[model samples]
Target: MPATTIHFVRHGQVYNPEHVLYERLPGFHLSERGVRMAQATAQFVAENPATQSLAAIYSSPLDRTKETADIVCQAVNQARRVRQEKPLSVQFDQRLIEAGNNFRGKRIGRGDGALWRDGNWRLLTNLMKPSWGESYRSIASRMTDFTYEQVARYPGQQILVVSHESPIWTLRHLLETGRPEHNMFLRHAALASITSITFDSSTQKVLGITYADPAGGVQ
Candidate 1:
């Protein structure tokens, strides 16, 4: 835990640009829309100025997160007029995996048995503890701890953390100002969306969620 600004950015959209549920399926790359989204993320962070001062970048081992981190690093680097090699070394933190999905091996779509018009369908109830997957409590606790620990390593600072949707949303559920359990289904940390949090290093109590999706415009 540290008195630092933790910027948690969700990974870019997956190759499943069709908006299907993509989980546990490893090696999915950024789709064309995802690439453009990532670039928009880069430009937003680059032009924002406040985000150009990150000291370290950490990400999930997932390809989507890694790709997003790379582009963000370049944008921030270019913004700061940096002239050094390896401006930022991105580190992978596994605690950032997406909320375990039961539909991992299947192609999720309208025709798929798992795909649902309403995310809260009875089949998907208690998504955290999906009969097919992991618990919300587990994901939330681990991710919050990981984020707090990392923030401590760099106090009073800003760090970029590229992670998956569920993990990021879980963290948000724990730190955000809204209803506590809204994250189980409706929490949408879109592609390249950012959620910021701060907590006391000693007590580990979340001070608050400072800013979220500060630059993610429509869609």
Candidate 2:
């Protein structure tokens, strides 16, 4: 069977000086180092034979993710131009958006106006299922839906996805463990990392999963 691979990338660091939970918030673009991180990943993808000819690019419609996607797209398209291949644009997908959170605009862990302060501490009832905001199942569901569609659309090919940490890791957790619930603090999807999952085109079964941290050394 032909195989299809999806490269899911978590966006780079955001320019959040306030350190508030910028979950699904506006005006959170990439920091300078974040741009460098994205550029590193972009160069890796453009030069890597396995991913240089990506079929499509999808991104969450958020400032940080879009910025990262834009940088990668530029590099990939420039490389494609050298080979006379048609350039691809970043396609925004709502399913790839950041997981919803109840702590938007609030800082967590200690100090004044923390998320745990006031009555918000009640939301910490469950960590596995993440009672604080959107459930892991929901995040995995949306990401899986998008993945399956792309798998069918670009059978035997590869694609790039720029999204937030929770959605990317949640889907991987579900695929690997047969469950979406996990410890939030133990996620492995680092900033600007790529989690590539290959699927059997006809069966949609995961054939293999690999991870690369091209921008890991940027920080």
Candidate 3:
């Protein structure tokens, strides 16, 4: 059996601060710092061994992720840098979008979110049982399902996925231990963060975890 490698990245920060939430807003583009973060992340991928193995790149259809993917593609342009095949072209997919939330258009920093009475967004555990947003299980299911399906189809390919915070964290939880606690506590993936998971088609064991975030890593 062979192995499948995936490079999953969370989207950079959006330019909204006064908003209560931004569930699926179309115009929520990246902030200035976010641009730098994405640029650094792209550089990391560019110089890493994974770049040579990357068979495809997929991203959430949101503007932030789309833009991040574009910048990263530039870094992976070995066609210009090392005279390899054409540069990477990210394939946008709606299924990679964050799990649906009631915060569709609500401002995030107004008064208080249902779970976060202090204005900030709620933690995953606190938000887990509330109807204020989508359930953790629902998000976990979607991300993992799509990931597994992608791996099965691509076989030994290395892939990259650009998506949002929650969805990316949920996928990491599923990949790491597949335990309930990882979802509830251990998974705290950040904006513009990169998390890698490898699956051996040979032994069927999901091996290793290599995570990094140039902008404040995991804080």
The candidate that wins on lDDT is 2
Best-fitting candidate, scored by TM-score: 2
Model 2 alpha-carbon miss at residue 140, Å: 1.1
- To one decimal, what is the Cα RMSD in angstroms of model 1 from the true structure? 4.0
What lDDT does model 3 reach? 0.73
**Candidate 1 lDDT by residue in tens digits, 36-86:** 777787777667655656778888887788888888887877766654535
Q: What TM-score goes with each of the models? A: 0.80, 0.97, 0.82
Model 3 steric clash total: 8
Q: In terms of TM-score, how similar is model 1 to the real structure?
A: 0.80
For each of the candidates, the C-alpha root-mean-square deviation to the true structure, in angstroms, is 4.0, 1.1, 3.9
For model 2, how does the per-residue alpha-carbon lDDT over 41-124 read when each residue is reduced to its tens digit?
999999999788899999999999999999999999999999999999999999999999998988857788788788998988
Off by over 4 Å in 1: 17-20, 81-86, 109-128, 177-183, 212-219
Candidate 1's clash total is 2
How much is the lDDT of residue 104 in candidate 1? 59
Point out the higher-scoring one by lDDT: 2 or 3. 2
Stretches of candidate 2 exceeding 4 Å from the true structure = 109-112
Model 3: CA > 4 A from native: 78-81, 109-126, 179-186, 202-204, 217-219
